[model samples]
Target: MELRHLRCFLAVAEELHFARAAERLHVDQSPLSRTIKELEEELGTLLFARTTRSTRLTRAGRLFLERVPYVFTALDQARASVQDAAAGYHSQLRIALSDGISPERLSRLMALCRQDEPDVAIRFFEVPLAQQLKGLHEDLYDLGFAQSADVDDGILAVPAWSEPLRVAVPARHPLLAHKTIPLEEVLRYPLVMGDPEYCEGYCRQVDRILRSVDQVPLVTEQVKSLNLMMALVAAGYALGLAGASQIQTCRESGIVARPLDRKAVLTTWLLRPDAEAPESLERFVERVASLDAERRLTT
Candidate 1:
């Protein structure tokens, strides 16, 4: 009839004795006897066979006991799941990232987060700036990381960190002639760029800087990630643009990096909806902003 009735029935079914079931339930034997009688009367069937020496479950009682326990287990599991979500503890934290990110830097930030919140799950999506903007507003992501946040004004974007825009050059490029090349001189040559659609946030700034100097850079090639950008540059396609941290990620072969005119700063931003964020989101933003040092890769 009620949850308590189901519980009483389950306990009595398990023990097969009124006295023992009463003790297990922390109730008096008289109450236990009354509860079983009430359960049987409600169900219109005898639940147990009783004798002076022992008590045992009937066919119906055994079946019901199995079903009732399963129902309770399902209810308990659902309750726990809700509590976990309300506490801002998800099995996974869904993240949307802009392309051209330095894998090394991203890995380091993740290691720090995991070191503290071991149970937090990390699910990454390589999303374009347009997708990040739309999905974040619709409550589809817990966080969004971008080379810059120039696309959306509805989202609260905070500068999390910055890395120098390194120009990855081939071994014999004239640009490599300078230990730390200047931006103006580098722009004179064609530039290989990441897809502007995905990296609109970063490329917009680069475009602005180039326009100020009245330079229309020749497009040599297009790439997605910093690793690929560096690879293309190493093959001598054209000069490449990337953050200093990215250069560190791509220092595998003949690629070389130097400051591009006073080390043009490439900023990383922590993005969330402009509306009030959950405590979990706030915690992530805070941890990212308080990093003690720069990015590093983990095996």
Candidate 2:
């Protein structure tokens, strides 16, 4: 089939509505349907199952949706390659780090890349986990650090590094008396928490731990970043769960961090889109993968 047919199919696949897809493509209803029919005929499979008022992608459509975007990504990368080659510029890397990465870790990462790959220019975006997922799909960011979740097929994620999960307690808080606080024990105090819609995987794991003992966290505060969450904890508002690295420098800043008595922690990952990443992007991925192998200054 022609590329136009594929585009039409993709439009319908995305909107999941015949009329909307037709409007998006700047075409009328009948032509869009015909194009989808032609594509189905060529592929020998029905992509969508339709009713009078609604449409949904079939299993085949779901699989195809994961792949078709890669085609466009490859095309975009190819054009960028040619343009960069002609311009005499080597390559550029763009990265997105979640708020959980320690300030020291970020400083070291920047230093390491600049020292080792001086010819490459690096840019960083302080993105939340939810935005990172969409940016990865949009090719807006080359790589992202987040917990693994429902990632699409065209994205490849590697376990880069993990920090011990710690409980943030205020200095005068009664829980500070214990050298190691139990997860169940923390239920006595209100909790300041992250927004699950943005940080889905971490929130899910935290919920599983508390739910096992039939406990519901008294969420006194809902926050998206560790900085604000820690601030609230320091202000004697609520306790919080965050990476140990985040609180390494906070003990003197009036916030106390302690490990949970049972096994409780958060894991971070490095994700790369599958289509085509620049050389600089690939190098950053490799460096991040090997970061733990080196001496990471963790508290």
Candidate 3:
């Protein structure tokens, strides 16, 4: 019913223990318990099931937990909008990034936006692909970029740009003997891949490539970022697969990026709600298209 109720509910739902949640909230256990009880009575549902030894969320609690974080996100965005307005920004655009989008490309796009429209405040949120899609639908984000185009009906996905997928090899590794590594040879060694939960779009793209080969890959580890994957590859723990630009930007030493004998490309898509766009959004989309065109011309 109130902010405090939501806050207390979230704390307990996350901690799953009343005393621990109270400790986290810097409150006494009795008050925290009372707050939870008050919230439950108001909602007319049991949020948590507790026993002497354990506490866990009921079905209703789990469902409520799903929608609670968005409350805080909305509040934060509102605060940020006020701050941006005070800073003399006429408007704000919330853009979400998912699936470990290429930093070089994003920087170029952001620089272009700043140069073309200095009055517009561009805010970026790095979230998982699932969250990105949900935010787009909920109007939390105006647009998003990701490696996967797969989406539900309410969202539209269009290819913005693409880069070649390359294999990241450690220095002095046997695979480096070949200038262009074959897929079969790359799969023979263990690989460090992106975790699906964090990099769903990226994982989907990479998984499709891996599935093309008949042989099974030996994945040494699943990491959440390209930096970690490159680090593992640099250390000779395993090889890695990533976009060429991503491999080029990685500062880790002893990592060599080799192209595949066969061509493979990863495409980044611009995702937005499937509805009529405002003039500003239309201009932004045009800028994206022009940039991609320029890149193709120069490349």
Better of 1 and 2 by TM-score: 2
Candidate 3: tens digits of C-alpha lDDT, residues 1-299: 89999999999999989888999999999999999999999999999999999999999999999889888889989999999999999988889999889999988988998999999998888899998999999999999999999998899999999999999999999888899999999988999999999999998888888888899999879999998999899888999999999999999989899999887999999999999977778888999999999999998
Query: Which is superior by lDDT, 1 or 2?
Result: 2
Q: Could you tell me the TM-score of candidate 1? A: 0.65
lDDT of each: 0.75, 0.78, 0.92
Q: Which stretches in model 3 have alpha-carbon errors above 4 Å?
A: 15-31, 52-54
| Model 1 Cα lDDT, one tens digit per residue, 191-238 | 888778767777876676667666678877776666677777878877
How are the candidates ranked when ordered by TM-score, highest leading? 3, 2, 1
Residue-level lDDT for 170 in candidate 3: 92
Question: Tens digits of per-residue lDDT for model 2 on 100-186?
Answer: 556666677888897997766555666566667767888777887776554777888787777788898888888988999988899
Models 1 onward score TM values of: 0.65, 0.66, 0.93
- Cα RMSD of all models vs. native, in order, equals 19.5, 7.5, 1.9
Best by TM-score: 3
Error of 1 at 174 (Å): 2.0
User: Stretches of candidate 2 above 4 Å error?
Assistant: 1-89, 250-252, 295-299
Worst 10-residue stretch by lDDT in candidate 1?
290-299
